[model samples]
Target: MNWRRLWAVMLKEVRQLRRDRITLAMIIGIPVLQLVLFGYAINLNLRGLDAAIADQAGSAGSRALVMDMLATDVIVPVREARTPQELMALLKRGEISVGIAIPADFERRRIDGRAVAQVLVDGTDTVVQSAALQLAQVPLDTTPSANAGPLRDAGLSAAQRISVVSFYNPERRSAVNIVPGLIGIILTMTMVMFTSVAIVRERERGNMELLIATPLSRSELMVGKVLPYALIGLVQTTLVLLLGIWLFQVPIRGSLLDVYLASILLIVANLTMGLLISTKARSQFQSMQMTFFVFLPSILLSGFMFPFAGMPKIVQWLAELLPLTHFLRLIRGVMLRGAGLFELWPEVLALVVFTVAMMALAILRFRKRLD
Candidate 1:
């Protein structure tokens, strides 16, 4: 186990990884390009969802109630129909998420002090259906008398009822909530994938020997190799952020600097972890297989789509170790809650520790394997 031999191998590997275009693209170009496409533009929230209205009563009071439903941020009224049959067809065809019905005797019954209105929602989509149900009944919450029947409108004023507000994802907009999460996932996947490719490429081509023959120390070589990939990660982060602001109108409520700094730190940890995996893999195929193994757990356990609280306690606790979970917290806190440096220090520190540990392990493995 000669120290000089290890230093020589590390230097040559760094040079080869730097010169290879495939490695360069993986480390520098892919992460940025993907971050731009997947993180900034995609949305999961259901907003301004389509809705159909049936007005059998054709009364002024019924019309007013329909307007109130439309006024809420949840539903977008697409068309007015005369029959319930026409509205049902729209729902089956996937043209709308919900429909509202006013009975034929709505006006007459209301004037006579008897009133009833029905709202039909597609149960298939829990998110959209829930939004529709909440907004539709908000009016009812205000005037119990107003909803009792249309004829009774003369005595009750809806103006005095308490206002309802949305939590977590307000404005019922999907892009705002999803962009932050998309950023975290995209960064982790891209950074790890690229770094894995670089390490495996060296093993496949037998050029690692040429690197081991050089004078560069193992630590110096590792730093040099990681720096270029780190730059690429920064580029990707910038593109995603720019696109999110321009295309999706997602606000960066927190310090843009904090988001970038935290993201860079997170990317470094992801790349180092990838490097560690590559150190042990016998071939590129094995490296990729290992990547899938890591990716699935990180994504599912990371709480990108599934709520962390809803999962069993064990699953939630396991997810805490993945970099994605803490990164999501930082991204969402900054993007949605406008959190600052003070709020995000803990996540940044965790990322730093993870990166240092992974890089050290990869370096140690490389030294032992070469000896």
Candidate 2:
């Protein structure tokens, strides 16, 4: 080394970086975005989990336990179940994360010094399940001396306990949860990457100029490019579902039709997003880079691997914006919870809005590029 030559080369590179505005912005913006996502949005503290209560005892003791559990703020009762079966159904449907069943003899047992309550938890997400189990124990661990009101009147002692029952992968099998979510993750990765390079490849090959000279409308061109990938996405979804069922033994507890319909919407949403990336990217390499940017957030922030509720409020909001986040919920809700359109309409509607918005933006950007 020549010190002056190294300085001149470094200055030249900096000037080139300044000229490539998009890449420069990405270099600066992506790091900031990742820092914010990791530092502020990601959290493991579980709170405000949806809970269902089945108060068969209907006694003051049972009611006090419920209140104490609610006070913990770990789980909040969203619905009341009249029977144990109803509570289980709620758990199976993913409608509630935790279920409390106060036995009909709960009060009598408490008075007799043998009180026992059952807490049923959805164990699919191990992190949430672990937090929930600890939180559910709070009320049970309350000694008669510690409880001031009806709980003390019930003759409850430290012997009174809440037995936890894990439901949906009771063993906390990661496959049962991950396999279902893998369907969406696989679809997102393939669908977005496959289509992201479509238009940019055309431009790279110099075909874009010829196509633009034709009378084809932007919408027509976009549809023509995206339809093939949409079909490919559906085929990929079917193959993945079969593999998951056969290889992982992941049960499809819900209607296959519901899963297919939601999968289609998810596919279209991602495909449109790819189209939007293609519109912005001037080269195939840039398109792939942009797709990876989208892909990372889809995988990390979508609650596919992490508990959605574990993420902070702002991160949750950002997660909600990703199509994969909603799709994961839809797929898991249908496959594990047997959720119907009524339970899933919100996610479906979100996918619809995302698809339309991405398509509109892609078209607008394409036209601007043409002009």
Decoy 2 TM-score against native: 0.86
TM-score of 1: 0.57
* Winning model by lDDT: 2
Q: What is the lDDT of residue 195 in candidate 1?
A: 75
Q: Model 1: which residue pairs collide?
A: 8-211, 8-212, 8-214, 9-211, 9-212, 12-211, 13-211, 32-236, 110-151
Compute each candidate's TM-score over C-alphas: 0.57, 0.86
Per-candidate alpha-carbon RMSD to the true structure: 15.6, 3.8
The candidate 2 region of ten consecutive residues with least summed lDDT is: 141-150
lDDT of 1 by residue, 269-329 (tens): 8989888887867667667766766786677666576544334445567777788878877
**Which stretches of candidate 1 lie above 4 Å from their native place?**
1-164, 368-371
Model 2 C-alpha lDDT per residue in residues 1-371, reported as the tens digit of each score: 99999999999999988987777878987898789777776677888888888888886667888888788888888887999899887876677888888899875556445546777888778887787777445645334433433344344433236677787677787888998888789889988898889888887787878897889998999988888888898898899888988888888878999989888998999999999998888777778788878988888899986678777777788889999998887888888767785677788889999999999998888862443
